[model samples]
Target: MLSLNSSAMYTGASALSALAAALLGTGTFWPIGLLYEAANVLVAIIAAAAIRERGAAGH
Candidate 1:
């Protein structure tokens, strides 16, 4: 369940970032793009940690 939840969260964040980047265009307004990218990375890290904890608990 945790795995599925994390995957969904990661996927949603990625899709949102991509959509924002496409709509905003990544030129002079690169800070917003960078912010989205950073958010994606943060989400990935959090999901990974959750998955890892879930795995460890089964052992």
Candidate 2:
């Protein structure tokens, strides 16, 4: 049997959750995956903007 470290296990669990979500939701798996990825990117952009704004404010 193979072993998974903590981070790898967490990542594996996340992937399984995404697969289940895609399978049970409406539409195909591909679209759901795309939407999931898009949401991640949107969040990343928002977080980056907030971090930059905070740094500029000097606090």
Candidate 3:
């Protein structure tokens, strides 16, 4: 099911963002923390856009 797969991907992306936030809040790994946070945000935005497009298409 494409919808199911898309939902999983969106959920995974959100999890990544949450994990990055947790790591950043912990105040450790300064350099890598910034990188992960940026990556998470990017992934989340892309995932959200994909989900939106799928929804618009009636998927």
Which one is best on TM-score?
A: 2
Q: Per-residue error at 7 for model 1, in Å? A: 22
The Cα error of candidate 1 at residue 32, in Å, is 0.4
lDDT of 2 by residue, 1-59 (tens): 24557777689669868776867676566766776787689879989999999999996
Answer with 1 or 3, whichever has the higher lDDT. 3
For model 3, the superposed segments whose C-alpha errors exceed 4 Å read: 1-28
lDDT for model 1? 0.82
Write down the TM-score of every candidate: 0.53, 0.54, 0.50
**Which pairs in model 1 have colliding backbones?**
none
Cα distance off (Å), candidate 1, residue 21 = 14
RMSD of 2: 7.3
| Descending-TM-score candidate ranking | 2, 1, 3
Worst 10 residues of 1 by lDDT: 22-31
- lDDT score, candidate 3, position 25: 79
* Residue runs of model 1 more than 4 Å from their true location after superposition: 1-27
| lDDT of candidate 1 over 1-59, digit per residue (tens) | 99999999899878877877776774556777677688779979989999999999999
Better of 1 and 3 by TM-score: 1
